[model samples]
Target: MFKKLKITCDEATTICDKNQYGEATLLEKIKLNIHFIRCKICFKYTKQNMTLTKIYKGHAKSCKELKHCLSDTDKEVLKEKLNSFKV
Candidate 1:
Protein backbone atom coordinates (compact mmCIF):
# COMPACT_ATOMS: atom_id res chain seq x y z
CA MET A 1 0.00 0.00 0.00
CA PHE A 2 2.89 2.36 0.65
CA LYS A 3 4.45 1.60 -2.71
CA LYS A 4 2.76 4.53 -4.37
CA LEU A 5 4.22 7.04 -1.93
CA LYS A 6 7.58 8.26 -3.18
CA ILE A 7 8.68 9.94 0.06
CA THR A 8 11.46 8.48 2.22
CA CYS A 9 12.52 9.29 5.76
CA ASP A 10 15.71 11.05 4.67
CA GLU A 11 13.89 13.01 2.04
CA ALA A 12 11.19 13.93 4.48
CA THR A 13 13.68 15.14 7.08
CA THR A 14 15.58 17.18 4.53
CA ILE A 15 12.39 18.55 3.15
CA CYS A 16 11.11 19.37 6.61
CA ASP A 17 14.26 21.23 7.62
CA LYS A 18 14.63 23.07 4.36
CA ASN A 19 10.97 23.95 4.20
CA GLN A 20 11.16 25.31 7.73
CA TYR A 21 13.72 27.87 6.58
CA GLY A 22 12.15 28.58 3.19
CA GLU A 23 15.47 27.65 1.66
CA ALA A 24 14.71 24.33 0.01
CA THR A 25 16.03 23.71 -3.47
CA LEU A 26 13.57 24.02 -6.29
CA LEU A 27 13.50 20.31 -6.87
CA GLU A 28 13.10 19.53 -3.22
CA LYS A 29 10.28 22.02 -2.87
CA ILE A 30 8.62 20.64 -5.97
CA LYS A 31 8.82 17.11 -4.68
CA LEU A 32 7.32 18.15 -1.35
CA ASN A 33 4.64 20.14 -3.08
CA ILE A 34 3.68 17.10 -5.10
CA HIS A 35 3.70 14.86 -2.08
CA PHE A 36 1.58 17.32 -0.12
CA ILE A 37 -0.88 17.42 -2.94
CA ARG A 38 -1.62 13.76 -2.40
CA CYS A 39 -0.98 13.26 1.30
CA LYS A 40 -3.05 15.23 3.77
CA ILE A 41 -1.31 13.80 6.83
CA CYS A 42 2.16 14.64 5.60
CA PHE A 43 1.00 18.06 4.50
CA LYS A 44 -0.48 18.91 7.89
CA TYR A 45 2.57 17.57 9.67
CA THR A 46 4.89 19.65 7.55
CA LYS A 47 2.82 22.80 7.99
CA GLN A 48 2.67 22.50 11.77
CA ASN A 49 6.34 21.70 12.01
CA MET A 50 7.25 24.73 9.95
CA THR A 51 4.92 26.97 11.95
CA LEU A 52 6.44 25.82 15.21
CA THR A 53 9.94 26.40 13.92
CA LYS A 54 9.07 29.91 12.87
CA ILE A 55 7.60 30.66 16.25
CA TYR A 56 10.63 29.31 18.05
CA LYS A 57 13.05 31.16 15.84
CA GLY A 58 11.13 34.35 16.24
CA HIS A 59 11.20 33.97 19.99
CA ALA A 60 14.91 33.27 19.90
CA LYS A 61 15.53 36.45 17.99
CA SER A 62 14.09 38.39 20.88
CA CYS A 63 17.17 37.50 22.92
CA LYS A 64 19.75 36.60 20.28
CA GLU A 65 21.62 39.90 20.00
CA LEU A 66 22.63 40.40 23.63
CA LYS A 67 24.18 37.60 25.64
CA HIS A 68 22.78 38.86 28.93
CA CYS A 69 19.81 40.83 27.76
CA LEU A 70 17.15 38.28 28.40
CA SER A 71 15.40 38.61 31.73
CA ASP A 72 14.41 35.49 33.65
CA THR A 73 10.80 36.00 32.68
CA ASP A 74 11.75 36.40 29.02
CA LYS A 75 13.80 33.21 29.05
CA GLU A 76 11.04 31.31 30.76
CA VAL A 77 8.47 32.48 28.27
CA LEU A 78 10.61 31.61 25.31
CA LYS A 79 11.39 28.21 26.73
CA GLU A 80 7.77 27.54 27.36
CA LYS A 81 6.78 28.56 23.85
CA LEU A 82 9.46 26.41 22.26
CA ASN A 83 8.73 23.41 24.44
CA SER A 84 5.10 23.62 23.44
CA PHE A 85 6.09 22.40 19.99
CA LYS A 86 7.12 18.98 21.18
CA VAL A 87 4.71 16.15 20.54
Candidate 2:
Protein backbone atom coordinates (compact mmCIF):
# COMPACT_ATOMS: atom_id res chain seq x y z
CA MET A 1 0.00 0.00 0.00
CA PHE A 2 1.09 3.59 -0.63
CA LYS A 3 0.64 4.26 3.06
CA LYS A 4 3.44 1.86 3.79
CA LEU A 5 5.90 4.10 1.96
CA LYS A 6 4.62 7.41 3.26
CA ILE A 7 6.84 9.44 5.59
CA THR A 8 6.45 12.82 7.25
CA CYS A 9 8.85 15.72 6.76
CA ASP A 10 10.30 15.18 10.23
CA GLU A 11 10.99 11.52 9.48
CA ALA A 12 12.41 12.48 6.11
CA THR A 13 14.81 14.94 7.72
CA THR A 14 15.95 12.39 10.31
CA ILE A 15 16.54 9.87 7.55
CA CYS A 16 18.33 12.52 5.52
CA ASP A 17 20.68 13.20 8.45
CA LYS A 18 21.23 9.51 9.02
CA ASN A 19 21.90 9.02 5.30
CA GLN A 20 24.49 11.76 5.49
CA TYR A 21 26.22 9.90 8.30
CA GLY A 22 25.92 6.54 6.45
CA GLU A 23 23.66 5.32 9.25
CA ALA A 24 20.35 5.04 7.39
CA THR A 25 19.11 1.66 6.30
CA LEU A 26 18.14 0.93 2.71
CA LEU A 27 14.44 0.93 3.59
CA GLU A 28 14.72 4.32 5.28
CA LYS A 29 16.56 5.80 2.34
CA ILE A 30 13.95 4.42 -0.01
CA LYS A 31 11.18 5.91 2.08
CA LEU A 32 13.02 9.22 2.17
CA ASN A 33 13.27 9.24 -1.60
CA ILE A 34 9.58 8.44 -1.86
CA HIS A 35 8.79 11.32 0.46
CA PHE A 36 10.96 13.68 -1.56
CA ILE A 37 8.86 12.99 -4.64
CA ARG A 38 5.92 15.05 -3.37
CA CYS A 39 7.72 17.31 -0.86
CA LYS A 40 10.00 19.96 -2.30
CA ILE A 41 10.96 21.27 1.15
CA CYS A 42 12.33 17.91 2.30
CA PHE A 43 14.19 17.60 -1.00
CA LYS A 44 15.77 21.01 -0.54
CA TYR A 45 16.71 20.14 3.04
CA THR A 46 18.40 16.95 1.89
CA LYS A 47 20.28 18.90 -0.79
CA GLN A 48 21.46 21.50 1.71
CA ASN A 49 22.45 18.85 4.25
CA MET A 50 24.50 17.04 1.59
CA THR A 51 26.19 20.30 0.58
CA LEU A 52 27.13 21.15 4.17
CA THR A 53 28.47 17.64 4.75
CA LYS A 54 30.58 17.84 1.61
CA ILE A 55 31.93 21.23 2.61
CA TYR A 56 32.78 20.04 6.11
CA LYS A 57 34.48 16.92 4.76
CA GLY A 58 36.56 19.00 2.36
CA HIS A 59 37.56 21.38 5.16
CA ALA A 60 38.39 18.47 7.47
CA LYS A 61 40.81 16.95 4.94
CA SER A 62 42.74 20.22 4.67
CA CYS A 63 42.55 21.02 8.39
CA LYS A 64 44.26 17.78 9.41
CA GLU A 65 47.45 18.78 7.62
CA LEU A 66 47.79 21.96 9.66
CA LYS A 67 48.36 22.23 13.38
CA HIS A 68 46.26 24.64 15.42
CA CYS A 69 46.59 25.37 19.13
CA LEU A 70 45.72 28.12 21.55
CA SER A 71 48.38 30.31 23.14
CA ASP A 72 49.06 30.08 26.92
CA THR A 73 46.98 33.18 27.58
CA ASP A 74 44.06 31.75 25.57
CA LYS A 75 44.37 28.40 27.34
CA GLU A 76 44.36 30.12 30.74
CA VAL A 77 41.28 32.08 29.74
CA LEU A 78 39.54 28.90 28.56
CA LYS A 79 40.54 27.14 31.80
CA GLU A 80 39.11 30.00 33.85
CA LYS A 81 35.87 29.87 31.87
CA LEU A 82 35.56 26.11 32.38
CA ASN A 83 36.41 26.39 36.05
CA SER A 84 33.72 29.03 36.48
CA PHE A 85 31.14 26.72 34.87
CA LYS A 86 31.82 23.97 37.43
CA VAL A 87 29.28 23.72 40.23
Residue 12 shift from truth in candidate 1, angstroms? 2.8
Cα deviation in Å at residue 21, candidate 1?
1.4
Off by over 4 Å in 1: 1-5, 68-87
What total of clashing residue pairs does each candidate reach?
0, 0
lDDT of 2 by residue, 1-87 (tens): 889989999999999998998999999989999998899999999999999999999999999989988899999999999999995
The candidate that achieves the highest TM-score relative to the unseen native structure:
2
- By summed lDDT, the worst window of 10 consecutive residues in model 1 runs over 1-10
Between which residue pairs do clashes occur in model 1?
A: none
The sequence of per-residue lDDT tens digits that candidate 1 reaches over residues 2-65 is 4444676567667978778788887777677767766777777887897899799989898686
